[model samples]
Target: MSYTLDRGDLADLARGAALLGTGGGGDPYIGRLLVDQALRHGPGTITVLDPDDLRDDDFVIPTAQMGAPTVMVEKIPRGDEAVAALRALEDHLGRRADATMPIECGGINSMIPLLVAARTGLPVVDADGMGRAFPELQMETFSVYGVPGSPLAVGGENGETVIIDTGADNRRMEWLARGIAVRLGGVAHIAEYAMSGADVRRTAVPRTLGLGLRIGRALRAARENHRDPVEALADTMAGTLYDKVRVLFRGKVVDVERRTEAGFARGHATIAAFDGPRTLELTFQNEHLVARAGGEVRCVVPDLICVLEADTGEPITTEGLRYGQRAVVVGISTPDLMRSPEALGVFGPRAFGLDMEFQPVEDLVPL
Candidate 1:
């Protein structure tokens, strides 16, 4: 299955990407605007191709903006950074890319690749490495499946380009990329996880772009029809990889502790019931990793823990959380591949330095 992404789909795409972002991936609002402007003068539409439709030898590269999420909102891209990065990588590889793919299907990263594809007239793979957003580049199915993460290409807005060609692993790639991003004004367009179509079909999370679009459409329809947006999201996600969705907490932000450390937005948020003492604490490194209430774990990383505006049903990223705002916390299960023992070793709670056993959201907190 395939769909053409045009300007009309920008809002829904951003909305859905934000929901899947799980409180990270940077803001999609700017990304939508950038893509909208590009479409106005560039290609009329971007074709999203299914992973299964690719030839075994087709070349695919995943693209994303790497840096602190907080920094991205302040320093918007030049609208050509992703394409520039892709071009640089293609040059370094001595071959033109066949298509672009999202490293993850969340927030601005999901749309960045679409912009690249639109400008280059390349189809985008319908799949991604992570079904949801992750803080580190290594926390992807590509690494779990033993795919190389370099040679990565990082590009800046002002004609700056850096090519990393090394035998280092994915973790080292992330470290080197982070330092380069900080040097390049805290955000850089990155092209990595280059793989053949056969590898993508074997390791990437399939159909996530379509899933995000469906989720965005569901929320919009729910709001228009005066239905419960949360329920609408749950129904829309039913039977998909993220099948279960539930409201874990209904409260207001009472306190927040966040700081940008080592090129990541590391923080924690405290939410308390409007009329009760029940409180929930969430910790994160770009994305929320753990959700606990009264010293009990309600949700953990790899499983999504999203915070949304209670009234608008719009997701609020970690950087956007503020004191005294009414919010609803929602949890969804991760895709099966992300929950596998090997996959979990990279993104599970223990991976984040938390001493807790990994548990599915469904088992930890019932809907």
Candidate 2:
């Protein structure tokens, strides 16, 4: 499904995107404000397209912000780095970008491509490289499925730009860009994973943008109707790619041990149940990677462990986790494409250094 994305869609879009982001994309509030500004002065509205809408030869590029989400909350973008990075990548590739897509479907990342489209009059594809957010640049289906991530551009707020045009592997591109992003003051806008429309249709996760919008609208409607917003979120998630959604834990944040290290936000969080001694332990590198309770792993990477405000069902970024806040943790299964043996090998448990096999979140019942 394709549609026009204007300011009216942003509030809910950001809400839903934050939930789908799994807590690692850039700040959703900041991203929403940027796109709102873009609509006010740039294109006024962005056209969103389905991946199948693209011609086989159309030039598609994915754009995102690379670095700590914690850093982004304090250092707002100058509103120019996205287009600057896009331009640099376009110049390196020797062609104009026909359309832009999100490397991952996360808060800020989902908005970044629209920010670019708002500034440049390009359409945004409805699909994304990852169905949800991940920390590393290489942890995306676009790259794991054989698309090169180099010939990419990274740009800073002070107008500095770097174009990495190379045949090196995706991990190497992530390594070089990550170091540069840290040097660029802990964050930078990037354009990478240049591919054709056919490649996108084959490799990208489809309709996530629409899914996000539906989720946002559902949450808002539930709130207006005085229903349980978290229940509404789970209902909205049903019949979609992430159908196996459930409320795994309901409690207040008891502890958060977070640190900004090596250009990523790495951390662990503990949530204690409201009425029991039960607790959920979360380990993450940018996005929430694993969830465990009473020594039983409830949800592992590749599946999603999303944390939301208990009352409002507002999604929280990893950087936003704090002690004493009431929260609800949801376990959602990923699309089949993301759970395949080959795909799991790239982003599954071992990829995040967890010593466990991948299990569907639904299978991990109460301990």
Candidate 3:
């Protein structure tokens, strides 16, 4: 059966995107708002195409935003940048993309593709390159299947556009892009990793858009029906249920030691957990990369570590993590994507400079 994405699906899309993000896609809220606005303004329809439905000759591209998520919230998208990015890419390739897909499912990147689709009058595939979010561009499933990430286009907020096809590796590509992103005020719109539709079908994570819709709906329903948000989340992800934890701390961030040299939002969040003489430490770069409970390792890379509202289990992005947040710490397991050796090699503890060996959350969690 064919699938069609509509306005009502945004909530599910957002929730599913968060789930797939494995606690790392920056906040899904902005993406939801952006996409919601785009749909309302243009009222375009996104037609879902099965992988087999795509033609071998059909031009396809996976697109997203590049920069600190914190920058995105403050800078706000010019609203034209996503479409502009696609146009810039089309101009370079001298070909129109028949379809577009999200590079990742959570945060701005997830919904940016929808806006791009509306603007370009192209249908968006009901899938993404990564089932969940990752820190680097090359970490996508597209990269796993040998797709090249460049000759890409980035659209700045001021209606300016830059194209780069650095011969360097992914890290270098990140360096070059981030240099421009910083110049653009830490946010930029980009359409990259061009490939044919057939290739996208093979490399992309299928049905994630639909899954996203399911999650959004579940979250909304839970809120309206006064159901347990955590249980709703568990149902959607098929995740194991854990006892809800209390707020360890809440306070204005007294200090944040941060560095963007890694092309990620590298920083530590020290919060006064609820009570006397106690605090929680969160280490992150882009996504929440690590968490500590009273300085003891509670979670690390390849696992999902998120800071949410103390009262509500809503996620807080790395960029969104601030001082003075009354927050609860939740550790969700990473999706199956990172379990693969290739995926692990890119984002495992070693990749994050940890001396400890990797352990799947399923193994570490109490059964």
Candidate 4:
């Protein structure tokens, strides 16, 4: 029913979260740091509750950081914001929150629940809304299961907060949340999708926490044994390692174009990756949505378009893309879990406003 937390578990959780993040969710580093720091402080204990364990009267909600993961690096959270989000949401709902659930656990979302659990003395559900990370709050399984995204509360670093309640429709809830996040400087703390335990069981991705713990373990083992972390990761995720594509001209970042629109971190990461006359260009919205080599479309989303350390094969999250960084473009499949029409309808190319159809990652990468 409950278990003690440790570094090993965190590692696995991060890894699993990354896979579940699909091709997005920012980076998992911040989540790792937050959880590690929280555990180090030893406020109390973190417990994982089962979905069926919750009572009809039990109050449950999902908590996560909402904003551009890129801005989070420059604008660090003020530490108490997560708890503040929970408190604000509870105050608005007029109900005591009995447990916290991860909205999605690809990156910081994974750790926010743990932080909330430790700080608020609530147990965390071992599940998440999306089996992997999605670009919008409305895109979660909760939406699929008919849960509303409001009366939600968002907390900021300076003790500022906002509560949103929409009469109907989750998409509007996402829009409001995004607008606030932009005003908050590309990052905001949020508590959303308040639901009953039975609802959570029906909507949340089951055993994701345990799955995250496993991913962390696989990465740790790969690092300790000097194995290729990517391969180790592939095996763990049961994902196919797509064949390499031509180097989309590897160089330093020259320009980055971004704008906060419709509650999504929409942007492009441009780099000069050629030594001579050959250069490349990449375009993305939430994740690396598309790539171009010599003006040719080389990679696309609905598949995993990832930037990794050339030497280490570590993934670079959407927010982590920066200038003057030399990284390799790696493409992997989205795993069958996310390849369904329901999943694609939300995160597929059309959802991001791209004119192109959703192509499997394998179709674009060269053999």
Say which candidate scores most in lDDT. 1
Instruction: Identify the superior model by TM-score, candidate 3 or candidate 4.
Output: 3
User: For model 4, where is the 10-residue window of minimal lDDT?
Assistant: 239-248
lDDT of 1: 0.90
Model 2 Cα lDDT, one tens digit per residue, 1-367? 6789899999989988998899889887898999999899877889999887899999998888889998999999998898999999898778999999999888798899889999899999999988999898889898778888988899999999998855748878888999999999999999999899999999999999889889889988987888998779878887899988878899999999999999999999999999999999999899999888998888888998899888888888899999998999998889999988878888989988889999888788542
Q: Which ten-residue region of model 1 has the weakest summed lDDT?
A: 161-170
* Model 2: lDDT of residue 148: 86
- Candidate ranking under TM-score, highest first, comes to 1, 2, 3, 4
- Kindly list the per-residue Cα lDDT of model 4 for residues 60-165, writing each as its tens digit: 9888988776577677777778789888988877888889989985777888888787767788988787665667778777776678888889898889989988
Model 1: residues with Cα > 4 Å off, grouped in runs: none
By summed lDDT, the worst window of 10 consecutive residues in model 2 runs over 358-367
- Per-residue lDDT tens digits for candidate 3, residues 1-367, read 4467777777667765664565466566677777778778875466767666788878887778887665555667767887888889899989988888888876667788887776666777766766667777767777766677787788888999988887536656666777888888877888888888778767777766766677667766777787766667667766322222222235434456666653356778887745577766777767766666576666667666656555455556666666676765656665565557886776777777767767655454444
TM-score for all models, in order of appearance: 0.98, 0.98, 0.84, 0.80
Show model 3 residue runs off by greater than 4 Å: 15-27, 50-52, 239-263, 270-280, 294-296, 322-326
Relative to the true structure, how large is the alpha-carbon lDDT of every model? Answer: 0.90, 0.89, 0.69, 0.71
Count of clashes, each model: 0, 0, 16, 13
Regions of model 2 farther than 4 Å from truth: 166-168
Report the candidate with higher TM-score, 1 versus 4.
Answer: 1
Residue 64 in model 3: shift from native, Å?
Answer: 0.9
